[model samples]
Target: MNGLKGLYLEDLVVGQSASYGKTVTETDIVMFAGMSGDTNPVHLNQDYAETTMFEGRIAHGMLSAGFISTVLGTRLPGPGTIYLSQSLQFKAPVRIGDTVTAKVEVREIIAAKKRAILETNCYVGDRCVIAGEAVVMVPSRA
Candidate 1:
């Protein structure tokens, strides 16, 4: 690890993983809507959401996906890592009060580019709510 508390490129290995979790809340939903300007009724209006396929207000998919950022930025390759790209698939609704667990595992590393590809996923209990992949650039020790 570096002094910044992040793994240097040389320190990472395929299959290494880390995770973090948070419970979605009304405050979180409201605040996210404000910050992201994603006030979609399905996420904020219970009545409208009730008519949707999910049948009730659901937390923003991006909010659950943010948990993946938390894992990559604060754990695993950590603080100094720079995100190159991410692709996510929303698998299920994340309801208020559901605890979402985000996990990221290193899948590949390119030494010349000092980059890593990771498998990212978020779960509510045993049910997967989000699945994705991320590519990040890690600082080189040399």
Candidate 2:
């Protein structure tokens, strides 16, 4: 999926939003756990997970955060955007096969600084699984 040329700082508008979705698969959970060194039993061992409140294995929280990155870096300001910082809160367990949709909306922009602040969130059907904000420096049209 190719994205169009990115929007420059001057082109952003408050309240604008973009979204993308992905199904959390077992492979995705395993790979993310391996790559991130998050070997927690709740994410890697279903038997262990079943003993806990979630009832089964859950995907890494950061894995759901990556979906938010996809929307910010590919759909909004896009390609040339520079990610500055992000703050996130994990609200719910994302089980394998659950479809997650990430959404980002322009919250504020500092034009002189070429920066933007956005509200970021991920949802599973009607429930919000993650909520956060991101600061990014968007490229100039020049």
Candidate 3:
């Protein structure tokens, strides 16, 4: 994948997009928990989570959001892009074994600043799990 070159600021189109998918797994949950120190029972303790509205352990919302980061870093504007800001709404739970697909679409461009505003979304099957927007500073070829 490193052999490929990502788009520079001047190359982007308004409707450009990219996506990637990953299946949420127990290991992923645990690893993300350890890495992020988000040891919430809803994500770590099944017995504790069972009594909650989820009724079962669910993956951390941020973990699913990371998929959106992966798509941006590895695809769309690709490498060299710098994340500026993001706003996310967690719409649904992502349970273990669920396959989530993260997608990003270019919505606006600031050529002078070499920046882009993208509409980001993550879906579990037909249901949307996360919705958001991101601003990234795409590097130029100068």
Candidate 3, residue 127: the lDDT equals: 96
Estimated TM-score per prediction?
A: 0.96, 0.94, 0.96
- lDDT per model, in order? 0.94, 0.91, 0.93
* lDDT string, candidate 1, 94-124, tens digits: 9999999999999999999999999999999
Question: Which residue pairs clash within candidate 3?
Answer: none
Q: How would you encode candidate 2's per-residue C-alpha lDDT over 111-133 as one tens digit per residue?
A: 88999999999999989999999
**What is the lDDT for 45 in model 1?**
96
Looking at model 1, report the run of 10 residues with the lowest lDDT sum: 1-10
TM-score of 3: 0.96
Instruction: State the local distance difference test value for candidate 2.
Output: 0.91
Worst 10 residues of 2 by lDDT: 1-10
Clashes of 2: 0
Judge candidate 3 at residue 119 and give its lDDT: 97
Position 53, candidate 3: lDDT: 98
> For residues 104-142, could you state the per-residue lDDT of candidate 3 as single tens digits?
999999988889999999999989999999999998887
